[model samples]
Target: MTTLICTLQDHRDDVNWCAFSGNLLATCSGDKTLRVYSTSDFSELAFSPLSGHGYSVHCCCFSACGQFLASCSTDATVVIWSMVSGEIEAVLEHPGRSPVRICALSPDSVHLVSGASDGTLALWDFPSKQLCRTGTVNEATLVACSFSPCSQVFVTGSTYGDLRLWDLEMRQLHAEKNAHDLGVTCCTFAPSILSGGQVVQFRLASCGQDSQLKIWAINKFNFGGYKMHLLHTLTGQSAPVLSCAYSSDGQLLVSGSVDKTVTVYDANNALLLYTLNQHERYVTACCFSPTAPIIATGSMDKTVNIWRLEDGCRGRDGKSVPEQSALTSSEGRKKIYLPIHLCIS
Candidate 1:
């Protein structure tokens, strides 16, 4: 069963994004600040509500080892902060001075990519904090980006309803046009990689303004050719899907939507497992813990809800059967709900 552990109501404005590192939870907001909390107790860190960005902080991501965090802002820059000291480590200015909508760190922490409102993407050398290259996607406003498990390539989704793959050299390897009907909001790569013979495969989950969540299979062949194929389209949420994430084990997927609900799914089979309806406003962001059975979801209501999966609550192939889940709201009231299934298109 999934249980609502606690709710963090610290952000003053809409929570734009939420992320979980090994032991910490980081949340960004339209209030122009970022907050850090301890995953163990969901308490705000002493130096939290980090005030460095001049404008709304759109997205934040942790380094592979969780030593540092990078946040992008409408101020046209990405700020890197030291997780231990909670101080600014570096500030990366976008090449064209356009508002940065999203940023992501490579799995190996060797590279960083930041996307701008003007469709420009800057690839940076993480260690040196130097800009290596820059590229653009026509006139599309880039919104979503994620790195593959192997860290050699990354995927980017945009307001143009396309998902593009790029290598470390800032070269566009492949593009999936019209992947979503409307704009893409968020995309994430599964943590694990599948390898067989000369082919390597990776799974990706992306949600969009089309009110659909999609699973994609990205494959790399021996001849250095790449291909992308649609695996499944989930139409569980009635409203536009905003954010989606894959569990650390790649066994489960979670998404938050404009319908004020959060949905959890069996990632392997694209089966809906749970639909959490506690947010009073649009659910804007969702993330899975890298080291625990925990989820952090942010909403337009300016709160971040933390959920925990019971020790034995596994889906699909697991032996335990999920009957119901309980939610403990911030007001100390409890609510329970039965799981609802959704169709896979």
Candidate 2:
């Protein structure tokens, strides 16, 4: 096993989100800057300094086509940038008192959804540069928001433990429920392709301040309504699970935690694998590489570590051994490569 193959150090403040577009990586930080890096050599490619946000950047994402970058900050503004020119294309701001907590762009890049600290969710049309609709969630502060893969629906999770689904076209609430015991910090919908041939069997995963990870299967009941049933409850992390991501194949789930580790689990509730003591501090973000079998995790320790999916294979003593010498160097970095087959079950 090897440690991080590359390390990019440009953010002086807390790095909140790290996203990839092909071989390019985009990162947003409290330093009031958005940076783009080449994943091949971990070299800095472009630096766009943004100064409108008065507070820390909470989240950032790249559009599906990799042509635009969207970011939200505690200053309550969502800024959209053109990747080609590195210019701010649009700035979506709330009135005077709202603080934007999370933002997500639709797959088509025509619509954007954002949640605010005031428990309000807003939908914006990118082409028209206008707010299309707004709805009050009637809960505590909203923490996380996600758009469905189909781009027709969006969901927001609140600090009050409520998860509400909204239909973008009708601008009405489709479903609402208390999905967790503690405040939800992050939530994501599984890819539609992962459901096999069942279009209605959708899965949603959420993690909260309670340090528990829960997976729900949303299925239609006999005659009229939809029901959410808990499919799995993952335990063992000593701290809150701050972020989670599903593999492109949808067979594996990876989560970063305040416990200073990243845990990997199968689609079922089974514990397929885990990586401990990687970061010296809390892991703030994690994501699977778009093309490689790599998972990148950013930490409060001010560094990002890339772990190979093949690192889960164990030796005779039940310890994962380095499968390759690719990461062994005099730089004093650590690497663990477990075979990918161990995580498929």
| Highest-scoring model, lDDT | 1
Off by over 4 Å in 1: 311-313, 316-345
Question: Candidate 1, residues 71-91: lDDT per residue as tens digits?
Answer: 999999999999999999999
lDDT of candidate 1 at residue 72, scale 0 to 100? 99
* Candidate 1 backbone collisions, by pair: none
lDDT of each: 0.89, 0.69
Candidate 2 residue runs with Cα over 4 Å from true position: 1-3, 48-52, 95-97, 169-177, 194-199, 220-225, 311-345
TM-score of each: 0.93, 0.84
Q: Write the per-residue lDDT of candidate 2 for residues 201-251, one digit (tens) a residue.
A: 667778877888778776633353455678888875778888877766566
Model 1 lowest lDDT segment of ten = 336-345
Clashes of each: 0, 14
Please give me the total number of clashing residue pairs in predicted model 2: 14
